[model samples]
Target: MKQKVAVLGAGSWGTALAKTLVENGHDVMIWGNHEKQIDEINEHHTNTHYLPDVKLPEALKGTLDLAACIADADAVLFVVPTKATREVAAKFAAVCQNKPVVIHASKGLEKDTHKRISVVLAEEIPADKRQDIVVLSGPSHAEEVAVRDVTTITAASENLASAEYVQSLFSNEYFRIYTNQDVIGVETGAALKNIIALGAGALHGLGFGDNAKAAIMTRGLAEISRLGVAMGADPLTFIGLSGVGDLIVTCTSVHSRNWRAGDLLGKGHKLDGILENMGMIVEGVSTTRAAYELAQEMGIEMPITQAIYDVLYNDVDVDDAIRAIMLRDYKSEQEFTFN
Candidate 1:
């Protein structure tokens, strides 16, 4: 029952997933655009650039050639950043044949356009060739996942049978995968949570305790849910794995790039300086732009998201954004729970 699998992007999440597939006894190949990453994975069984500390499984073959990586694979996991999705997927469109079920581990809505990762997938990958598109998301940190830290994620597809199939492929003792059919909800929940996480990180960096962080996490989720509902997603899906569960993990984890970046930014360092030092994609930064705009279109009140947007994109001082969030018009804590 071994199926061929390909994982594009050799970043922490991508490498961990490729390694997981290999451990699951599947034929897994990883595609990296950088030749050095390919060499590191092939020769040293490691991805020195992204997830340098962890060792990758030997079964996870790495290659620069897209055709070789996608060769007859039953599943293809796209783990590239949100900004790169369209361009990389365009190139993937040419070489990927017999459209396999795609799994997107990267989370973000495209800047300005507000297109979710799956939307980009559908646009780039021809419909006739597509089998099923799936989203895998939850409270997962690549650092914890690499060390096998009891990670649980939801594997969701529009088709129940396909979702179960994808779930069965990854569920194990260390890793547990659930199934959901709310594709839009799952994707939105996953993407929007990163913004909340960034806000939480800033709270932490500003010497705010768990109380303030918890408040942001709670209200942040409300904003995300409101926006998702406005955008055609089921409300209850926000309560599930893809929503609250993912939000908690990302906001609290030290391993979160968005959180870490926001933490540094909160400490009064310039955005350019922080990013220059980290050399990683803080999805929340760009996702904030998308979320901020999407909320305006939907007319939902998302103070936390708007605050983060100002800090990242509007050149507003981090301390000022924090003050704005604190001074927002006060309302009942359960304003959304009118029942």
Candidate 2:
């Protein structure tokens, strides 16, 4: 059964998602901010700006006009970067013809609001008209998904029915989906894992090898779980796909923008140098501030997250940051909260 779907953002992840929908036999319309990207996907079946080699399907059409693209769609996939989510969602809501199920694919806390993505959606689009809201997240990278790599993610909504509905939208041989109702745990896990990913990337930047990365990843979860559990998340959710699963992949995977940003910084490049080269929003960059503030407010101790914060915001030298992390007073792993 074909359903009309609108995908916002023509970035790598958005393009990959649009491809999945088109291949699933949906009437997919993509909205790109750039005229060239819109032209590429609409007329040429490709987005040269992001995924260069992957050929998009003809079933996927692109447009720069947001209202025109989403007017008749049954659902809209918000795939824009976290920084742009609010502005785009506001414009999207203004011209929305009918409230369709909104599926947001971005991960990061709003710097200004400290609000979760779902909260932002609920605020921008009235709940009654918003239909259903769901978020899909996991270790899946856009490049790998574009190449048809085996990827699994979790679909989370306030209600299980909505989660299951979104689950059916992306399930295929190459892409697997799981449904969960813990939206806070799922979204928190998604956002905080990026900070840990930065720690892992810093270790990699220092040439620490797999053993160091594995250790960092394990301990990193301790911090992620501590803050999340304190804030009302299911502890078990952190052990699932949205938590450890996403953390391991993003930290170790070469395709992760956040990890790459940390890597560039570890190699002794300044923040400006890194941001200039990447040319994409590294969400962890902004979320680091939010996490630091959250941890302070909640009275939670997150050494790894703090170190990344220092390195990114305070201009702490990456080498000194690593040394500081290594020198933290030894205590039993579970002494603070895990046990």
Candidate 3:
């Protein structure tokens, strides 16, 4: 089926996804705020700033007019940063006339409320104008996906049919999509893994070996599962693509902005300077704070997240944070108790 798709956000992830949709034989339009980037996508079939030197499909278009981009579209995909999601969703809701299968690829919890992205979208997109919300997430990266590298991801929704529809809509030879009904687990894992990735990158920057990275990643999965289960997520979902799978790629891959940001932090760079230099959203930075607060409120024992949060928000030195984690009271590996 040839459906019109509106992709919100012209950043690296959004552009890569738009390229995927275009190759999948859909009528795809990317909605962005920057006029220059939009013009580049339209006139040159390129988004050099985000996906440098990667030529977009000639059929793919970019637009500043959100109304025009989404008008009569069969689906709306939100790939913007977590902070911008609500604002963009509100704008889209203002002009969306017909029901579209609302989907989001962005990963992160709301800063203060700690709500999942799907919850945020459901709140903003009118029930009358939207179908079930679907979340597309996994271990894939924008740079790799932009070049047509083989990638697999998950499409999760409470509505199984909606998840399957998204799975078919985006799947291709190189990009495979799996369906999962655990929206809570999928979204929680997707958002929280970035925080762990930051810790992994910091370990690298601190000159730690693979042992440290493995410990952080292993314990990080436990933390993610703990919080996720507390929020009514299926515990089994943590082992799937969106959980441990996403953790492996983001923590180790150089393409991860959060990892890079944490590496800089470990190397004595301030958060402001690192963020300014990267010129991309490091979701882990904000996620650390949000997760820290959420964990505290829920009484979840997430020592690694707490350590990263201290370093990121409390001005604790990275060395001190690492030391704190190392010196924490020893516990059995099977200490995880799902509420």
lDDT of each: 0.86, 0.87, 0.93
- Please tell me which predicted candidate would have the highest lDDT against the true structure: 3
Q: What is the per-residue lDDT of model 1 for residues 91-196, given as tens digits with 9 covering 90 to 100?
A: 8888877768888899999987899898899899897656888999888988788888898899988899889988988887899999999989999999999999
Off by over 4 Å in 3: 337-339
* Residue range 238-316, candidate 2, lDDT tens digits: 9999999999899988889888888777777788888888978888989999989888887899888898899888989
Highest TM-score, which number? 3
Range of the 10 consecutive residues with the lowest summed lDDT in candidate 3 = 330-339
Q: Cα miss at 96, model 1 (Å)?
A: 2.4
Better of 1 and 3 by TM-score: 3
Q: Higher TM-score: candidate 2 or 3?
A: 3
What candidate 2 gets wrong by more than 4 Å, as runs, is 336-339
Alpha carbon deviation, residue 57, candidate 3 (Å): 0.6
Cα lDDT tens digits, model 3, 162-265, are 99999999999999999999999999999999999999999888889899999999989999999999999999999999999999999998999988888888
Deviation from native of the Cα of residue 167 in model 3, angstroms: 0.6
How displaced is residue 204 in candidate 3, in Å?
A: 0.4
Give the deviation of candidate 2 from the true structure as CA RMSD: 1.3
